[model samples]
Structures are given as C-alpha cells and as structure tokens.
Target: MTLIDPRNRYPRPPFKTQPQDFPGLSANMGPEPDYGLDSYQSGERLKGLVALITGGDSGIGRAVAIAYAKEGADIALAYLDAEEKDAQNIASSIEAIGRRCLLLPGDIRKKTVCVDWIDETVKKLGGIDILVNNAAFQHPRKDLLDIEDEEWRCHFDTNIHGMFYLTKAALPHLKPGASIINTSSVNTRTPMSILIPYSMTKAAIANFTVSLAGSLVEKGIRVNSVLPGPIWTPFIATGMPAEQHESFGSQAPMGRPGQPAELAGAYVYLADPNNTYTTGALLPVHGGMPQL
Candidate 1:
C-alpha cells in the first residue's frame, strides 16, 4: 500500500468530459476522493454533542461528519437525492462509530427543507450544538455572459440563502456554547473568473461569519468560516468540463490538490467547545494557497 503524504505535491492528470458529469457522486470520480477513513483518529472532543452537516454525502462534508462521529458526536446529514448512495454509506459509517446518523436528503434551496432538517435533527439526536453549512453549488463558466439568470439565482439560494434559513431555525435549539461553521473558499479573497457566482456567495459567507459572530456573542454562540483551496472533491471531477480537471490543484503553492481529510482538522478545531475564545475566524485549509 502506498502511504499518501499530505505534504507532497499532487498532479492530477488531464481528464475531459461534459459538464456536471459526476453530479453528486464522488465514488464515481476518476480518482475517487478520499473521505479520510484511514488517516484520521478519534479524540472524542465532541462527545455527547449533536451536529447537522449539509452536503454530508461525500468530499469534505463526509470527512467532517465522520471525524465528528469519531469525536463522539451524533450527526444529522443533509444531502440531495442525487447523492443518496454516498449519503447512505456516510450514515452507515457514522453508525459504525457508535453514534446516531440521521440522513436528511433534500435540496437546501427550499426553505422548508432547511427547517425540517433541523427539526428532525433535534427530534432524533436530541439537539444540535454544531451546524456545518458545508453544502454549496458551483458551475464554472468561461465567460460572465455564459452564466444564466436562473443558474446565478440558484447559486445564491443553495449557497447563502439556505445557510440563513438553517441558522435561523437552529438558533432556538442552540445553546450558548454552540458553534456554527460555514464553508467559505479561497476565492473569497481572490475571485476566480470561472466561478464568479460561487465566489460571490463565499465572500458573502465570510462577511456573514464576521457579522454573525459579533451578533451572537451575547448569546455565546460562535460563528466562523473555513476557506478551502484546491481540494480534490466531486466538484473537480464533474462540475466543469472534463478538460479542466488535469491541473485542478496545480495552481496552489503546494502544487497539489488537498485531500478531503486535510480540511477535517480545521472543522473539528473550530467546533471545539473548549476553544471558546475563537470566533469569526477564517480558518484556511488551502495547501499553502496565498490568501491575497
């Protein structure tokens, strides 16, 4: 078995395909993304806590959910029907770790789904202490004019709007020590032309994290956002045309695509209840990708 080194530069060979080729299934990606089953260990830092993770079917979301389970937290996973296969596997893995996994499958674009997911989480897992707003939609376009009005609007609905809906619904159940982690991106600082809509939402997420952190301080709720660089996920495999996949992470300073497992640490650290003083922080897991 080849031991994967987190520090080495990774080269993703060229691949070309039609857009949205893989949809939500990471398992079917040419080089299956690692969800960190072998690389991570349990510290039980989140014992007795309950979390609701959006897009928990695969990639970083899956990694975070599994890590949280290892830390002794029960999970409520939100995902799309297209991701059901991977979602089921994630659920089973969480259960195998001796924690309950509640699978809530639906589009976050719908306000009702967001509300219902939180309600179901509280009902099943007792209460939510961690809310990971990790679900997002990104479609790369070569030109600004190529983006359609409907697609642009959908990005906001799925990315930022859903976060708002869920956070509002979860507030009542959240205690003073709860932590909310939103998935921002390196593009928040350096916008990529291909991902204009996605970048816009991420910047908004970072802004929301800071603004919300200040507002929630009185309630002792901490809010933060994570900025991920080029990490190998289903997004790289299928979001854009196949030709773009060859050098996906080559642009990062580290010259490699980070595995989903790399971001797991930041997610857990930000959610650490004992680390109470940390809030409104933008934790970057970007393989040395310069923020500026």
Candidate 2:
C-alpha cells in the first residue's frame, strides 16, 4: 500500500497579496476557495426561514449565507461598508439561487448600528428565525507594545460586544424554534500569544453561547458556536505579516489550512430544523485541531 503525506495539502509559500489588507478577497487566492457551488447537496433543510447574518460578505460567513439561501432561506446580510465588492458578490449569488437578499452595510461595533440593522432586517424579511453572529476582527501582534489600546478594545468591540449588541436587539424578535450560531475560533482552545485579546473575546463567546443557550432554549431559541481552525480566508493575508502569510495554517495537525466551504456544513447542520436537541454546543470544524 502507498502512504500519503499530510504536508502536501495546499503546500505553503502561498501566492496572494495585491490586497495586502484585512479581509482579503477570495478571487485572488492561489486555489480559489470552493464556495460549495460545485459541492454541498441541498435538501432545503431550512425551507421558508429568514436569517440575519453578520460578516456575510466573505469567507465562512459568505459560504454560510450562500448555503442558507440554497437551503431555502431568505437572508439579511450585514457586512462592513468597506467590503462592498465582496458583499455584492454574495448578494448576486444568493439572488441567483432564487432567494431574497437584503444587504445591510454597517459596523456592528456601533450598538445603534447593530440595533438599527436588526430592525431593518425584521421589517424587510417579515421576521427573523436564524441569527449568525459571524463578523470578527483580529490583529496578531508578537509583542504587547505593538497592540495599542484601541486595537485591544476593537477586538472586544467587534468580536464579543458587537455580538451582545446584535443578539440583545434581535432577541425579542426571534421566534420559537429559532437558532443563533456564533462564529468562534480554535484560538479559544489554544490561545495564541500574539492574539491574546482575540482569544479572550472568543472565550467569552463560548461562555455566552452556553449561558445564553440555557436562557433561550426554554423559549425555543437555541444557541451554539462554531470553533474553526485556520481557514484560508482574507482575514489572514490581510491581517498577518508578510512572512507569516506563507505559513499561515501549517501549524494545524492536518498540516494545512481549511477552506471556507469546508466549514459551511457545520453551520447548516446546526440551523437544520431537525436539530431541536442540539444547543449550547461548540462545534469544531478545525482540520485535526484539538478543540479541548
């Protein structure tokens, strides 16, 4: 029998830059990420539902938005204003799939914006049944000095606090049998020194999911979190240092980074109507990464 080597998966020394900024574009990656168009058999698991997803413009969020649409759900996608191009791409794809798309562009870090967007989504979509708190911001700094006060605050603001703002505003409108899926990270399990603030925020997210799940489940609104490994998204190429980019996800046990499309199924599974018993769980889609 022949043996296979794990390191061969998407060999590093990556080819991507032009947009050397945070939340990189998928179009520029070496092997363009699979957004499930060529895969993901759909059975309309979420038929006739409406979802509000933050960070639905790119990466995992983008994949989830498209998958939800294919599963027969109308979507209200909230993304940063700067990600207009990526957001438009998602919107077009969703619309093409015969699902309605309401694109809301704003910063979730602002409480008023998050609250206002939820109102707009409810008004346009008629009601909210699924909420994907997926938008996040992270900056890796090797030294403490490199992490400024504002950067630290931004991490909590965008990661955890923004989640609170959006979740609180959307809570009352969420009907029975609803689902709330929060996008967390593997960093919560194994904290990265450079990403201390990001790790703290992720830990808080897990706690929030479990605690909130308890309070909401009785009302028929379930809550869960997805703990993902190093997914090959623009979030890395743009936020990480140039030299580090090539070796971005090589540290995972699988010896490679995951693609955004790979994580879509977990979100879909959690949102499925049949998943009435699954809540307060942190589902990890990290290729061989230890969640505990």
User: Residue 227 error for model 1, in Å?
Assistant: 0.2
Q: Write the per-residue lDDT of candidate 1 for residues 1-292, one digit (tens) a residue.
A: 4676655533454444424554557766767777777667778999999999998999899999989999989999999898888998989888888899999999899999999999999998899999999998888899999999998998999999999999999999999999999999999999988899999999999999999999999999999989999888887766655676776777776777888877898999999999999999998888787777
- Per-residue C-alpha lDDT of model 2 across residues 209-274, encoded as one tens digit per residue: 999999997899999999998887877766666677667677778777887777898999999979
Q: Identify the runs in model 1 with alpha carbons over 4 angstroms from their true place.
A: 1-5, 9-19
Could you tell me every candidate's TM-score relative to the true structure? 0.95, 0.93
lDDT of 1 at 34: 72
